[model samples]
Target: MEENQINELVHSFITYDYNNLSINTEELDDGKFFSIATIEKNLGKQIFTPNFEAEFKLIKAISHPEIKKI
Candidate 1:
């Protein structure tokens, strides 16, 4: 695939999947917060390589501060 095509593919996938995911937060006894992402069981299997996982983590971490405010 061309570079632009790959970029568009990744962007579309992230936007769609992120919208579909369910995020939950909890307050720990020590006054800290814990957050998690959950996917519906009926959503079907996801296929991605380790690099994609790393990229997703990076994106999530970068936006965590803003996300925590919501």
Candidate 2:
């Protein structure tokens, strides 16, 4: 995918919280990329999971088997 598309996906993932948050990305020499984000909450400490809704949407978009060219 294009760089801009990748950036947009990353932005959507990070902003899923809808709160004041920040995400940072790091690229390793091996060409792998990872992201870290800080989420501010008012409640006590709790286990949190990364939101993958946007990613799932992307996957579903590309997984359609009818649109094929051979």
Candidate 3:
């Protein structure tokens, strides 16, 4: 995949998790922002693999300015 596409995917997962936790940007630490270590620690060895729907959702979400900030 392209670099931008990959970045969007990662961002989407981060946003999803953050929203689930009801966390705002100010409350998020550096470790929680696109850190592989944090993802592995929180998700427990389950690496993120985007399926078709997830890919679509990520693409859509990342394109939106509001969602991208989260």
Scored by TM-score, the top model is: 1
| lDDT of the candidates, in the order given | 0.40, 0.33, 0.46
lDDT of 3 by residue, 17-45 (tens): 54455447685553234443444344433
lDDT of 1 by residue, 3-63 (tens): 6653422321233334455434452222211233432221234544445455556666666
Ranking according to lDDT, highest score first: 3, 1, 2
lDDT of 2 at 61: 59
TM-score of each: 0.30, 0.21, 0.21
Model 2 lDDT at residue 69: 19
Weakest ten-residue segment in model 2 by summed lDDT:
30-39
What range of 10 consecutive residues in model 1 has the weakest lDDT sum? 27-36
Q: Candidate 3: give the clashing pairs.
A: none
* Residues 1-70 of candidate 2: C-alpha lDDT, one tens digit per residue: 7666433223333222435543334532222222222223311234232334344345435654532110
Q: What's every prediction's RMSD, in angstroms?
A: 14.3, 15.5, 13.3
Give Cα distance to truth, residue 40, candidate 2, Å: 27
